[model samples]
Target chain A: MSQDTLFDKVWDLHKVSSLPGGSDQIFIGLHLIHEVTSPQAFGALKDKNLKVKFPERTVATVDHIVPTDNQSRPFKDNLAEQMIETLEKNCLEHKIRFFNIGSGNQGIVHVVAPELGLTQPGMSIACGDSHTSTHGAFGSIAFGIGTSQVRDVLATQTIAMNKLKVRQIWCDNKLSNGVYAKDLVLHIISKLGVKAGVGFAYEFSGPAIDELSMEERMTICNMSIEGGARCGYINPDEKTFSYIKNKLCAPKNEHWDKALTWWKSLKSNENSIYDDVIKLDASKVEPTVTWGITPGQSISINQQIPLLDDLAPNDKLVAKEAYEYMSFKPGQLIKDTPIDVCFIGSCTNGRISDLRVAAKVLKDKKVSKNVKAFVVPGSEKVATEAKQEGIDQIFKDSGFQWREPGCSMCLAMNSDKLIGNQVSASSSNRNFKGRQGSPSGRTLLMSPAMVAAAAINGKVSDVREFIN
Target chain B: MRSKFTPPIGKISNINGQCISLIGNDIDTDRIIPARFLKCVNFDSLGEYVFEDDRKTLKGKHPFDLEENKNSSILVVNSNFGCGSSREHAPQALIRWGIKAILGESFADIFYSNCIAIGIPCFTLPKNSIEEIQKYCHNQFLFLEIDLKKSLAKSKYLNFNLEIKESSRKMFLSGEWDATATLLANTSLVEKKFKELPYIQFCNDN
Candidate 1:
């Protein structure tokens, strides 16, 4: 248990009560809902004849199943059409704000919330989507919950939660040119295996973390779920305040100073106690990629997959599983491995900043004929912003498709899928077997810029090669 | 084929049922129930698809596919189980498959909360204690008694005190587990906070 970390402070502030069993009935400050996981929750509500308690706190949007190309009503897929229609109806019935498609406000739940300034410091955010932790970039305690708990929040606005132990993941100075926040997070997950953060909230702090832009911080916090932490957060600073100011729903001029004062005070004190602390040199991190089914089973872009003899006894079994499932030989460099698709989207890497990086690299290069690459912005705002900057045209000129924003190919929920046994270089989180739609399809998780490189080469190549 | 098992719902504390063991550690939620199955209506029928792929690869030899383990309600095994994805469908699939209690070395935070939310109590115990219990469960003859109120699990000369958070145990035993009723009754407290937060805006009420 942590004594004075930022997590402890936010948790203490939201605690409605310390229940008899040592758990706290913590009030959720924001409850974000999307099409996929929320239908059953609303169904559960209807079954109980319950109305949403504080419709003010709950927000709805369509994602997961919305078609990136054709998002018009009565979608091409019936199941998806029904899911979106149901969510729209539920939002209407429950009086929660819904950011519908083409609403300009619509996008991935994680991406839109922050841009609208709905996500902020010292608040507790819960969403049905696992990437809810992305909001933690704003210094809020955001984590994912299930549909039932989603229903719990919709009906009551609080959840019975046991506080998590806090771990300060101290990152030292600036990242090298080619390595972005995505690579840093992947390196962190690879160093600390996916299961290491199970009972903890990771407090990402230090010069390296503090220096990242708001979008970069979000990319790091977004994958915190992949690392198995309940949530990962960086304390709010000037960058955090500046990013939220002038946003659509941000605090007006009258409340600006008051909000900033509260946000600043929520940071962990210098003497704050933590359960454990780990250190890493961000400068040492290189472009990284997952070689196996799990996010933790990754190696640097130029590195080789470990041989069975090279792995710890406990890891050899999963290595064998990955080898057999992915049909790859050990001791071979991850670079130069052939890829069938290059996907640049999802809550992880679909932000405009990621697009700007990829587009810069792809400006004069033609995509390899053997590779099918596309970019899906995290939301409409990202798409609009990227287009305004002519980043979309750079990608389009390079033979990549510029689709509407949604979680396309991030999961198999929609039509954007990797066909049978097709290997993908993806910027999204998760490389789970069958995660990209095909039962035997393979997904190699990498940075968007790396995906841009793979799109040009038709194989996993170092992003640094394109940089210089 | 969808099995004809309508698992009991709510206010569950003590479980008296046979135990079944799975072979591996860190069985992820994706393995518990694949992402494709996540598209359906309520998770009631998710049981039929639970480990559907793993069971297919195991060629009907997986523990869940074994005829003798058909009616078993206690899942006994392993460390860091249910350690991926926040989809509560994993437990919903387990509960729908008739699993009432999970005895393991440890559980993932979100999965454990999902279980407790729906009255599925996940019991944590020492590793050796779990290994000892697995032997009995693997034999498919152990009819264990899990008493949540007392925090103990026992079956014929194999008795061990289980570790569950006191609040969780209280929730299960006293039927305060749902939390919907409790939260619904406290709207004023939530409304007050909503108004106090300067950044918050209330969308119109129906």
Candidate 2:
């Protein structure tokens, strides 16, 4: 068991009691609900005739099923409109704070919370969505839950869970120029393998982690689920405190100082022991991309897809399936592979900083005519910030569509979907078969700058080339 | 898909059913029940669309679509089953399609908890044993009688010990896997922790 790590500290602080089943009943400091997952949970509560125990602590938002092209009232898809309506009704009945569309606070739940200063260090957060781990960037103990657990949290403000062991991923060196946090995380997942994090909560640390911006840290923690860890976090630091200082829900002047003092003390002790430790050199990480269905199947932009003979015996089955599904030959270069679509959005890479980097790459460039490229901000706030900075205009000038914010084609619950077997260079997290809509559609996961570069070239190209 | 769907209830100590083997590693939630089918207020209709895309691609050749596996109530698979997304609909869809228990080499964290939360007991076996069972199912049907107390799965031809988290096994045997009631039992402690948490005091806004 891990001791004295940040995860242990936060978990111990929130534990309510030990249940008869050997799982701890931990109070949820924050519960985030969304359109896609909460409706069913609310129905379950109604079925059980239970009321929400701590309605004030839970927050609601609409995403996953919202259309990016239109923000109007009734959605074209009746089922989506019904789902959102169900969420609206549930939130209203439960008296929870909801950031509805056009509220200026609406976006992806993960993006909206941190920007609104709702996510904080030393907190235990739970949500119905898997990317809830994204909030762990602030040093909180956050993880995703299924609908039944969602009901448990709603009814009792606590959940029965087995504590996760902590693993320290120590990155020794700073990333080189043109390499982003997305690349670093993808590299980490590829190195650790997806299932390596099953019973562990990854604590990303060392100089490379400290050097990343708040949004970059969020990007790293956002894909922790893809790496198979239900939760991943970075220790709170000056960057974290500064980022949360003046947001909508951040503490007031006197309270801010108190929060900061507590946050500073939230880090792991100098000699804190972790359940496991792995070290890597971030300076050696390149702009990486996923070539297979799972996020673990990745390589540097310039590298070729691995051959079956080179794979470990355990990995051969999935690798063969990936090869067939992706239509890629063994040893074929991932670069210069043609793409039909280019997408830049999702909780993973749909922040203002991601937009700025992509806009810089697309300043005087034009998207290839053969490709349909679009940029959906992670939230409405990100869209507003990008417009104020003229990033939207730059993308428009480059023939890329700048649209409203939501999780657009990332999971394809909305109308934005890949048609037929079209291939997409996506800034989103998952590249699972049919994850982007069409059963045969393919997704190539990359950083926003890489997606922008691919949009300009109509194929997978290294973002460093554009940077140089 | 297989009679009217009925959910599992209290004290699930024994599960005797036909085993349906799915051969793959890292079989994710998205593939189990695609994102397109999630736009609903309930999971009642999810059974018809479980593995919709994969089933469509396989053209009735999928194990779920096979005549012999139609009534299989236990799922057998390889490593890292249910690896992506925290969607409970995946397991709901499986249970609705007649899966009452699962045997795998390994399972993702959230998905395993989700299965346990919804009354599906997921057990594990060694890689070689799982592979042997999967191979055995390829030629003929394998019916397993699983005893949660002993953590054992037995068939006429073979017997092996199963592995499950002790806490999860306890939850299943005691019917505490429906965790809301168990968690609610600690209401006073929950309120005390809420009051004691430093962030709750300092962060001000709820």
lDDT of each: 0.86, 0.93
Taking the tens digit of each residue's C-alpha lDDT, what string does model 1 give over A266-320? 9999999999899999999999999998888899998999899988765676778
* Model 1 chain B: lowest-lDDT 10 consecutive positions: B197-206
Per-residue CA lDDT of candidate 2, range B1-206, in tens? 77698788889999999999999999999999999999888999999899999999999999989999998999999999998899999999998998999999999999999999999999999999999999999999999999999999999998989999999999898887898888877888888888888877776664
Q: Write the per-residue lDDT of candidate 1 for residues B92-120, one digit (tens) a residue.
A: 89988888889888887789889888778
lDDT of 1 at B131: 81
State residue B113's C-alpha deviation in candidate 1, in Å.
0.8
How does candidate 2 fare on TM-score?
0.99
Candidate with the greatest TM-score versus the true structure: 2
